[model samples]
Target: MNDQRLRLDLAALADEVTAVDLRDRTLRTSRRLGIQRAVATSAAALVLIAAATGTAFAIRPDQTAPPLPADTPSVTATPTPNQSPTPTPSTSADDPSGAPPSGGSGTNTPSVQFGKLFYGPADVTRVKTAILRSWRPGGSTVQLLALPDIAFKGNMSVSSDGHRVAWVDSNNNLVVADADGSGKQQIRSNVDPYCVGAAWSPDRRQLLFRELAEPGGPGRFGMLDLRSAEMTVRWWASEPAACNAVWSADGRTIALTTDYGVTLYGADGTKKRVVPGFSRDGWSTDDVVSLAPNGSRVALLRRNMGGGDAGDVARDLRVNVVLDTRTGKQVTLPLGGRTLRQVYFQTDGSMVVRVQAGSGYAVLLVDEDGKKISETAEPASLKDMQILAVVD
Candidate 1:
């Protein structure tokens, strides 16, 4: 299980691995500029950090991440509903109770498309906006402001000096609530309905999550430790299953990409480095590793085919790999979009993902060898009043 190749220097083996290599050295290859592109994968040549000290995305081949010919947010426009999570600083909600966690306390909610706080990537000089939902237990700031239906799905994490913010609530629990939701608490709960978030710590305090239990089940998946207030698990199964998570940016190492591959968990939890094949349903470890505000490297969207010949999955998509979460090594982006439920990872590796198209998806922001930088169309009015709880 060894890809053999080695040079080892990922910032001295993941400490924020940096040697730098992204100053634009010339590119252009949607197939020799003939442009029939889409259906790609296969890459190498890593290390790049100097846009002062953080950045991603810059693929070329006449550059084409296409497919925004514009169908537009499906055109009905309706985010202005029952809104009021407190801070319209900007950002997400989805489930309004369909019956699930009966043990009760499920209060830290936010889903229904989800949003409670956002505004990430802060360090090149410190630019922030990180608030994101929290605060329920004693009532004075962990801010969960509304909590009724629960929202703020994924990506908006911060740590390398952006102040704080590490998401995931609704019923999946595992919160840190501050940087906006102010003082709210919990530190842990049932977790993983597909759980894919809660990463912050390289000094932001402590957080990282993942779980999948069954193989011999008794509970134990991968990295889990919030440090103070209470919660502490970090049990990377030698058995059971379900484990995919990431957290680096000084939170002290916690990378776990599994279905069975890719791992790194120190900060005192142990199990460092199992990563050889890495796959958590192909690519996407919850909130997708994408770190780098000084925590040093980890930007993965990954899933490529782009050498084409598989035809028709909606006109055949070809390439979209972007790994290097500390030397798994990869880089290629020229997509056509197919399944992608959500991606979001910016600071250069580039991405805003969620493409289903035609009848639904339209959130494009792809780049970093994948192209198509911004296509947002609509979904911003916030007027009604029932959005209930997204307070950052």
Candidate 2:
């Protein structure tokens, strides 16, 4: 009976040990599963946070995240409604007029057409050799001629059609040449060496110039027919300083500025009218005078001689006085307070003016009513240069 009891107890002990070992194994497996679930939950939470903040967390095929470019920022996949894409260049045809398209650079836009402007040295007295050049608006200057021993102390006159130019030479001879300095001709010799101005007729067939009876004597007006090569004395003036002949566009009237005032004469040398406010003694060396195409108005520089000695007087050189020959009253010009340097009347009764512009000069085209039409800045190389003629 004792032996049976022992065997039964041994069997019970073995069952108990087996049960404890199974429980221990179950606890270990539960703890291991709990740790895996916690790790997976944390990883999912991180991915969710990155998506909500618009930060991309890229995963590689190897289940690892690589570093992003330092310079690049995390961007959202969707764009706003107002966002515009970068524009690509177009290959369409350009404008037919060679003008830039709208919203293009204005620096490449075409400038206003001011025609060819003939100019020379500002101070000819200092240079023995000088060049005549032509400047077009928005174009480079081209040398037209090289003058040797230039005797004329004034501006040259270009024909209305821009075909010819006329000036006096060092030999006291009237020289006429093509606009390009070709086909030169000495039409008249032994003429007044100091005849500072000349004018071309409306037909471009006659030239009006000054003639002196003798050197250092009083001068008169002369007209030369280019076709016939005939010369005629048109008018006789009593003053020695009477010169600067300007013609009306119709070629019916002529105007001369004298020491006393401006004298208007018919084409037949008859006295038409005398507009008397100008004094040649007070005028500057480069003083320009122009007559209206209809012979109704005259423009000149007005000098204000202040109180002082003749040599020390302060002369104002800024005022431009345009007088109506019929009423002898000043016509107001819209100059915008810019100082006038020179003025020339166009064939259409408009005026081209050179005004002082901050150490350089600017050209302005104004209508008959003194309204600004267009303006262009002169090249810096033409500072203090003279506008001899405007070829339009």
Candidate 3:
């Protein structure tokens, strides 16, 4: 946990941060009003405030390349939906090969090789290794822990309970270490675990892993039951839809999406309802946004039926939508991205959201109707860091 100073500015569009409709994923603001003061997106049914800064955006491969090289991304983007139309929350955002976007003039920095970063306790940089002599930082007084062999490279994922952490080491081993960096046990796998990503059950007892037991064998799907220490492979490819397996917090039905749309399945693989029109149809698109404690109201990233943000990329697109999961009838809100990620709802139906904005993340406790009450950050040590979780 290097005490490196991370300074970010968000003084562009200074306005009172407030409520956003949870129906669409668009904003109701503009980028020309200088730097944004702060965004107010919440964890549950949050909205966005897209303000395109003059700063270079990571140009898509399909988009016309910017003359200047790209810089280290301050953001992560999901790969574009495959042309084949598969359903899954866990698909690589790029193409079928799971590649990152291609565009470079030596300045293309995707922040891939700096090392898997995380909020290490508070902010302390000290380590005592038994492997080698005293490891030190670049002759500077600042403390550093450089365990080259114990590499935690690639994508790092923290469990929902925030206790265990799983990441791929340089050797492609799926390693689960204690949040306090104590017990480090490596799970066996040949392919990089981070490549396909790993999903821990709500109880963290089982892992729904995507792998092949043998090189020439078929891709394996299903549970690595910790309780029994057994591997129960399912007869499903798991992809072309997205999620490998998403267990309910209590560990019951696993809801997933396929090439067509979202579906819920029993623990024994009994197919439930195939959520309709999650993909684009008649100008409507929906994605499972949340699973409340009661499992009654499932939040969705719902796009409008007849709306376009062609001219206003910042403020004229889709909004968040909340659905009564039991019945298909839904209630749409005009939420935007800047504030969508700010909203957070508990299993008890209570929610909190950030009221102010900065490049650095800080959560604000809000009232029921999306009103801000306080601010808190998502425990991190980097600058402008927003944590995105991937469940395979």
Candidate 4:
């Protein structure tokens, strides 16, 4: 919501935009060409035109960091997988014996201080509840109400301002609401409840979501124009296929991973760039990408082989790799010994990855140079935590 304006010269990239492969893609040709004009605007400040819905607000070049809610917590990160961590007894500022602190006595109280954090809470359960934690604000913990009747299927995305969240409800309805758990609205209904992907644009003006008609059924990708109430389909798979939809941090690009490599698309659903390398691996319930804030780099979690029991599958599986989407350059993270589950990008140009540790999951902050910074406290359930947002 920053009023700051960034003027970009789109004329230089106009040729590249037009040269993108638009041959046999699923997006409509007329619509795609129209979007190219809007994105490659010759005006002073590049504009976004949502056709018929009018123009979305001029997107500021710099993304604003999400705000810290009153209940944010301070956190202590655990060590790497090889290190044997010594159990540190919990202590309070008022007491030296590491005994329980007074004041709250079971009630939730706001922490006095906080730090920069990347948050990912536990998954929603049948009890409609999950535990929320902070990576930096010094380890405050709270229980958040999971949306009614839905276990979080794939990912729950928090907008840039940290005020709104978008997820799929148990009914397969795309739900948007305030972060404080108010103003719950189901934007899309009567679709498949097995929704897989949900993400918010950097400006928080739109959302990208995908769902299937049923298990192993056809997949549909749609963009919800928050300001104009327009739902546009970017692509609809003819047969059953895995869809991994990722919106760039700059709010201008979207990447969809099919059995092939990643297909890059414009904000208006036009095909932009296609960088092929990803395997035609089997469809995973957790197919995703962690795009850098500047839209330069991306981290992908490649699924290895596993079957039979769930525990056995989780034990020996998966590898994460960071790739420069433009040059096809990649750097593999040193997470070979652990089961890497999820990956995300922090605003500081670092990577926030969630890895399976023991019976739970730990959030690791990795720098842009691909060095491990620290690992936060492990959550009770590995299935619960997915990096939601990063606050600096």
Candidate 5:
């Protein structure tokens, strides 16, 4: 009932009933990327911590705060429906190497196709501060800025064009800045500290995050429009037991992982369909649901919690399941028998999938139909690195 008691009980329950996915843990602990790792290891903790810390200012139906006034410059306009949603690189006067800026241009520069990967140290507990870095897959990593450790715990997000990044800081303030860590702006201060996820809208003008309606309460979803600096709360008619939100590439639909399954909603927040049996109840995490670019399908990491035997746990958790959002049918992936660790959808409908190799993992670019396009070259050591955003 109490937060401490609940955390202890959940830890005990985890030890008794949950199987630890060693590969998943290794990837998460080493790379410190993906929300699934958090869901797998700390879902219960996140819920309890949120409920505990947010009770004092939990949102009430009648007491919702008025939208904060816009203080920062408006975000770039959303791309037209006919235009590509991928980001073009901006000219940076700060960096001569052509690397992304740490504090250079805003969003006003001319657009050209730009590709970069943003990632950083996964474990910042010891250091207190986390350093974010940007690098091409095979190129040198550039140090961006040092941020609070909380910024990386399912709270950090990179824009579709890989030009911007957003995260929640230690004080529960939502901050947005450029990919190289420049032009920092604090959008929302004192947001629910336990909100475990943040996602960039496809057009890159807004962000999606989880909100709690009350202290120690159920979950609600909200969107922050950078262009207007206004917050919109959706799913107000009902509360999900637990959830995480993601946007479709077209910016037309939003998908949420819930205790019941994955639910789809239009941009206007109207429920479209419910893909049941993919709930986050037993073994789902915040990073499990990734919507396709076209908003027709969703990729889910459905962990196969092994039998009662402890020895069987690691092997069972490597399974993955993707579904057709329209039909709620399971779709098979052409993985060539490699265990799928995680899957992320790109703006073009293709996916970058992480699969288990002998002691590490491999990244593959795959087509919409599940055909492998090519394998990406990663750095020699991924020990504390995580791929935050990708633009091809």
Candidate 6:
């Protein structure tokens, strides 16, 4: 196939890939500062739309892409129960089931812990409560804590070491606690009218959170020092605006996304440099970007924009590209037919991806060269199964 034809094919396939998660869409539109919410990676529903006079098509960052299909049904499944040999959170029979794929090992000691958070039935009786759980990847799970029914628009974050979890509590306090819900403590009260995003420092001793100045309005970023129990604004910008921040594994540099591009910041909140060849355009409004374990690179998903009827636009496409933080060089892996849902970089530079599977999704580890390392069996329930941190 010609290069042009191949581009068209990839774009079409990308459009067809769908995973419905309302929280992701809300963040893209709202960009509240809090925890990383799960993005949708549902089913394949590709359609080809021919380009029109006003439509521009390009595979570069900062360009508009196709929007996700409208009204994609939300995923609803009863979390199946599983047996675990390790300690796990308290779970009811109807709780979401989580365990390593079969043949992985029933007694495998987990090097990493995964966080699973679920909100209630959005169908008839609105159960506004939220539940958070922690589990060793491919192992057993332990219930962390549960929040009484509240507005479902905020965020929850877990530390890279997987030993700590944080979120905004009912009293609008920034709460940090042990992964298993022990030693719970409030870090800051009324940190923001809405605490929407939170990220831990590499050492897990500090955290940066985004809080809306007002409901659904642009907000500033703040940092919390756990030892001192002090919280202060991080000076993310001279003015309040939406930006996404992630810390390097060493905690020396922070990658912050702006309307222009990605910026690096010193731990003391000093500006480093604007990353070349990295544009904030074409990304889902929420900043779907991840820092490499070494902090020298980043991976960001394209914000797909669709136009024209399925017949006129002729295409729908999306991609995840890795950018070199130092040189701003980018690498796009040829995933073939895989629909990306969640992505994280390992300490050795390999990438672990969660992609769409039959009615659900599965986890796979791939090398930098786009080669598959290993993949776990498809879990029976993906509703609340979220991979929070990876330990190799």
**Per-prediction TM-score to the true structure, in the order listed:** 0.28, 0.62, 0.45, 0.55, 0.63, 0.59
Q: Name the best candidate (by lDDT).
A: 2
Q: Cα RMSD to native, each candidate?
A: 19.1, 43.0, 22.5, 18.3, 11.5, 15.8
Q: Which ten-residue region of model 6 has the weakest summed lDDT?
A: 45-54
Instruction: State the lDDT of candidate 6 residue by residue for 1-392, as single tens digits.
Output: 67999999899999997867666555443332222223334321010000000010110011011221112211111121122222234444332455556422122223322222222211111344555544334544345456433222333555654556666654556777765567678767654422234566656667676554543333566666776735544555543233446555545666665444567676666777766763433322224245654456666543423311111111111125667767767766534476775566543445556666667656665555555655665444444344444432
The 10-residue segment with the lowest total lDDT in model 2:
55-64
Encode model 1's per-residue lDDT on 1-392: one tens digit a residue.
24333445543467665656533321222222221212234221111001011111111001012222111211121122123333323223222221121212113212112112122111112212222332111122222223211122232244433334444443455555444455656566654423334544444444444442333112444344555434556554453232334444234445544443345555455655544435544432321333322223344434423322111111111113445544566644333535443343432224444444455433444443455544431122111111111211
Query: Which tens-of-lDDT digit does each residue in 264-328 have in candidate 2?
Result: 77665667777755444543211325666566776665553331122211111122777776666
Candidate 1 least-lDDT 10 residues: 44-53
Give the TM-score ranking, best first. 5, 2, 6, 4, 3, 1
What is the alpha-carbon lDDT for the whole of candidate 5? 0.51
Clashing pairs in 5: 39-285, 55-215, 102-180
With candidate 1 superimposed using the best TM-score fit, by how many Å does residue 390's alpha carbon deviate from the native?
A: 12
Question: Using TM-score as the measure, which candidate wins?
Answer: 5
List per-prediction Cα lDDT, in the order shown: 0.33, 0.52, 0.34, 0.45, 0.51, 0.46
lDDT of 5 by residue, 1-392 (tens): 67999999888888877555677555544332222222234665655443322211000001011221121111221222122222323322222344322211123212211235555554443555667666553344556666655565446676766667777665557788875567889887645444434567767666766553444333455667778735544434544443445666666666765443567776556776776554433433233346665566677655432322221111111227777776667767766687876566655556666666566555666656666655544444554565555544
Q: Evaluate residue 127 in candidate 4 and report its C-alpha lDDT on the 0 to 100 scale.
A: 41
Candidates 3 and 4 compared: the better one by TM-score is 4
Q: Which runs in model 5 stand beyond 4 Å of their true positions?
A: 1-115, 122-125, 138-140, 211-220, 229-242, 279-286, 305-319
For candidate 4, the lDDT comes to 0.45
Better of 3 and 6 by TM-score: 6
Which model is ahead, 1 or 6, in terms of lDDT? 6
Candidate 4 residue lDDT tens string, 1-392: 23332223455455466555644442443332321222345432232111111111111111444422211221122112211111112311221232222211122212211123324333232344443323331233332334442323244566655555666654456787765566778787643333333667777777766554433232566666788746644453332243445666556566655444555666666666655455435312133355665556656654432321111111100226666677656766646377676566654455656677667665565665666655554434223445444533
